[model samples]
Target: MKYSYEFYRDHLEMLRIKLPGEIELFADFIEDISIEQKADEYITKVENVLNGLYQDFEIQLNATSVLIKKDMTVLEHFYTYEEPYENEMETEEFKELMLIWKSKIPERFKKKEN
Candidate 1:
């Protein structure tokens, strides 16, 4: 697989506070809908969903840390965010804000319980 399950799981864990109680169901939703059997495809779908959250809600996600640049292979894009911070987000406070924003998922956006 291009990406291991741990990679995807780690990102999910980082976003755990944002996710609702229906996390297992959400996982199933992403995995079952993936076109590829590999776990990477499911991860891609989950990333897209998270990106959608960022865009739709103007959520301040540190997408540079979690996003996979389309058309680039995993190896090519893996460490791009590991570079020294020098832009608008260079401060530790900004990084902390990103984490807070990541966890600030709107309640309505979470998976609804039946």
Candidate 2:
């Protein structure tokens, strides 16, 4: 099962904490499923960004590559990345609508599409 930061973030409770039981269930599932072999760069990028370890503000990930830009790259290359996600169109205008399944974007980033 692929997991995205936004997915986890969306499901996180009001206090940014996940319920132990919910997590336990996921752990059980993850432990049993054999994930496809992941590349080293993907794992490395997760470690850097998860800690806010970069001088650069942006970090991203696709299933295959870790995108990083500028001096943030360790004496290597620059170009960058974030979590696995899909684009969807819906507005918080209907926050109470219920039954929405994807993660919610912060209101501040919501904008008029060009």
Off by over 4 Å in 1: 1-87, 106-114
Q: What does the lDDT read for residue 27 in candidate 2?
A: 22
lDDT tens digits, residue span 41-96, model 1: 33434355445533311111222222223322111112235443212211222223
Point to the candidate with the largest lDDT: 1
Per model, state how many residue pairs clash: 0, 7
* lDDT (Cα) of model 1: 0.28
Q: After superposition, how far is residue 91 of candidate 2 from its true place, in Å?
A: 23
Q: Per-residue alpha-carbon lDDT of model 2 for 23-108, expressed as tens digits?
A: 22222112222222332333344345445675332223222122333222211112214221222111121111111221222321
TM-score of 1: 0.19
lDDT of 2 at 24: 24
